[model samples]
Target: MFFSKLVMAALAATVLAEKTPVTPLLLANFERYAAFASAAYSSDCANPPFNSTVVRYINDVPTDTQATLFRDDIAQQFIISFRGTSDIQDFVTDLDQVLVPCVAQGIQCPTCLCWQGYLIQYNAVANTVKSAIDAGLLQYPGYSLVVTGHSMGGALASLAAASLDGQGLPLIAYTYGQPRTGNQAYANLIDSAFNGTMYRLTHTNDGVPQIPAQSDGYRHHSREYWQSDDPPTIENTFQCQGQEPSDCNQSEPGYGIGNGGIGINAAHLSYFGISTGNPLDPNAAC
Candidate 1:
């Protein structure tokens, strides 16, 4: 009987040792939405700009079928707190000039001020991360907190990442077509703080990341592209090179673009429905 009890204890210990880290789960959840946004952008390339009412619906009406589905289906996957906010339109309007070509081609435009809202939203998210950490979410030391979003959401994700990094939180953020939120210095600081924890997913020739830098110092990450015909998978084709932790190389492939380039039309839209890669496959390397 003593031997059997010892065997049971060993098995329990083994099970505990084998548990998956929460950090990866959080990162995976972020990547999942990025993949979804990629698909959504591709499918809706021809849709019109988001009107004010549509934006309102997305932000205010949590009970709306689509919003609820997005929250229930996606947000719950990780311990994420989502705050839907307006001002995505303002970002689009601000970058109206450089985004014209992509906008005309039906690619979505990523907005600048939308990132501002994200910064606001991140204050809450940052607190959550702090609370989680204080509560011992990182007791395993391998657990990670993640934040993700699609299109404008992606842009916001980047901002949140920066804020979290400032607070010295361990976070991994995956954003799709996240536009340029600030100057080169800002991007560099974020990259340095987050290290390999930030991944930006972009498709071939997508224009959202191509925003004209306000200064010569502004430089975005180097992108890894997924072939248009490839299936969505977490492979080296989907990672981008940011400004820090030189050895942090990883990849994944997927669809989506946040609108931004040369015009008002491309403003305030999220790309959907394109084929690329799965952001959450454990077997895949990126």
Candidate 2:
């Protein structure tokens, strides 16, 4: 009887913790960040409701990797977002998954090896993106610097965040439906660099987050924020503490079966009750 009572008390406490109401500011930040990620899918990069405006639009013909530099004056943020897989070349980048030594100006992790594809993609635009970020910060010296994206874009943004670190600017990254980005060493480097500011948002049953499988020596940086429920509300959002959490999204049905980005489903299409990562979505620009 005593053991059973103790178990019930523990369960009750856990339930109470989950029910903690989310602050409006926190929810709005996630929604605004999602809008930025979605905007990368479109050329407008405009969001009036969030008081954001496109500062620059990058379309590198050679690499065909697009990025948007936008600012949310209300949030005091200068954000750079990457576009997800859209062309045949992007798929080629995704499949070229060889792990190579990470190259980032601010990172000095000698043993870190990241996905060759992502590194190459970041390299193509790294200088331009850095210049844009530097200009934005120079004008608005107090503003925070943010990097964000979804799907393939998210993968590149993760690398950008690592490369932007230790630059004397306040840097944070938010990635949605991002794939495994690097080997364990690279993951450790990112995990340590961002600390509390990195928000890796994964949704329920989103198979895209499962591959470049662990067997392939790919690993994700911590800490991940998983929305376990369908609508991905504050109540269901939990910060997964480890590099990989078995009881979180990784434990979802057949998630392990995802290979070569094959298990990608509708969950990857949208985030936070809105459709994101779609290039043609008419509302994505808002």
Candidate 3:
């Protein structure tokens, strides 16, 4: 009985120790790390700072799915960074926004209809991650896992984070310019699952975050961190209530699809300090 009690105590302590807290410094590093992983989808970057730490890369092709696993022995951390939509099929997947029953294993799940394409793609990427994580557990016994991505990749990261959370793994996720992933039910489920561990960031007038349209019963995760068009600074941000608010992404009028050509393009591409160009027209959406 004494031995069993000691074992239980040890297990409890391990669980408590696994939860990694999010800080400003950590978020800044993760945002850059996620960008580097996202770029790997488009370019062959040479001698990137994160290249040395990539223990595994999951690229499930003839589809736009890619992820990188960075294991830092010095910090004892394991991070899974997902790549965003890269091609026509990916954009087609995003626009094919039909929500069907989120059923699995012969049972009807609460949420009706997840994004069919994204869900299919996310599962493929997640299968690879699951196998990698299982092996990583044996290799790096107490390492914490952090997941991050941008745009469509961010949506997939959210799904992956929630699914992994089910296995009792402590989750820390950071996603930028993420669109609404699912219906209200799906959002509710994931929000509660990742409650404090997820930080979903949306820059000013980012139309991507304003979609897959809340009018269709789609919703965002709670406590969204809204960065401003003014300038990138920690002081120039706001954590909006629930999903939409006057001060966040929904602040602008119209469908939030953006107005002019520059506006539409700028809204989607400017997150993480990657600028498309300054508008020839001063009034272009920021």
Q: Rank candidates by lDDT, best first.
A: 2, 3, 1
Q: What TM-score would each prediction reach against the true structure?
A: 0.46, 0.88, 0.77
60-167 per-residue lDDT for model 1 (tens digits)? 222211111111222222222222222444344334333111111111223222233334433434444445444544343444455555444555556656655555
For all candidates, what are the clash counts? 39, 0, 3
Candidate 1 error regions (>4 Å): 1-31, 35-143, 212-218, 222-230, 233-286
Ranked by lDDT, the better of candidates 1 and 2 is 2
- Tell me, by lDDT, which candidate is best: 2
Instruction: Give the per-residue lDDT digits (tens) of candidate 3, residues 6-73.
Output: 99999876643433333577446545554543543433334433433666778888666877676766
Worst 10 residues of 1 by lDDT: 48-57
Model 2 error, position 91 (Å)? 0.9
lDDT of 3: 0.65
